[model samples]
Target: MTNKPDVSVLCFEGHKVRVLQLSGDPWFIAKDVCQALEIVNHRMALKALDHDEKGVNLTYTPGGQQLMRIVSESGFYKLIARSRKASTPNTFAHRFSNWVFREVIPSIRKHGAYGVPWALLHDFTRRSADSVERGSQAGKALVIRKIEKHQLAHEEKHLLDCFQPRLALGGESDAE
Candidate 1:
């Protein structure tokens, strides 16, 4: 299995919130959590927080690694409380608070990870498998084209050897 860090994006009422698992605790990306709760000025909002915010390096797909400011679970609830007090409508904050308390936190407590329901996980797995299969097929075609043009038998072996790791992921079968 690929030793990738556990990072997940959750959607709350059309907002994308990014969460990271670090050292056995879940951390929320400050900006993302703020955005989900409709907090306009994240910097100002974070200032009212009683807990010290922390910065950590997280992998950003298609853009390499980035340093992100994050908040602990308690700090996250504190931000929610602050948001609920500050928001004019309060409905969004209430809804978000409910979802986190009823669903998100419970899942984390029980599963040791953000509990993505099985249906969602299954859909994600299916899509990921499709994408990987397509990529592997495309890669195989390109490798074949290159091998044909260069007539390099050893290079073909080396290329196939490089793909071995990906093939081991179980998305695609070995291509001879």
Candidate 2:
């Protein structure tokens, strides 16, 4: 696909990996995945992945348009298989893979469909982000006034807020 991929930067244990799900599961930035897996040389790791399993994607970011090397879900598994912690349970690699497979992929497949009108979807996305940022303040005015909901304490609200940092990295439960 020549169209620009919708890239999302996901932080895993402080390492940020970019993902794009256009039709199937999603492709992850090879370099980022390799870094997350603690592989010293991404080029060496990428050389082992099959042709169809790897691809190049063009993504638009605030910095500018850039070409990124991406790996398919299968290629990602290859990288994980090559990881030192692949056979170990509850390792960082395993947890990161689990986070992507269990949490990220499912969510992407559910909401990343292209049926919605582009303009409306774009507006909604922008507004939703703005809402989250503004509502995260002391009073949570949106929830209290607009949604007419219960008042949530700081700790209770922070654990599951839009800007939640814990669950985004290490807190997500791994089924394995």
Worst ten in a row by lDDT for model 2 = 113-122
TM-score of each: 0.56, 0.53
Give RMSD (Å) of candidate 1 vs. truth.
Answer: 17.5
List of clashing residue pairs for candidate 1 = none
Off by over 4 Å in 1: 1-4, 85-90, 115-176
- Count residue pairs with overlapping backbones in model 1: 0
lDDT of 2: 0.71
- Over 47-67, each residue of candidate 1 has an lDDT whose tens digit, in order, gives 777655544445454345676
Residue 134's lDDT within candidate 2 is 76
Residue 150 of candidate 2: its Cα lDDT?
43
**Candidate 2 residue pairs in clash (backbone atoms < 3 Å):** none
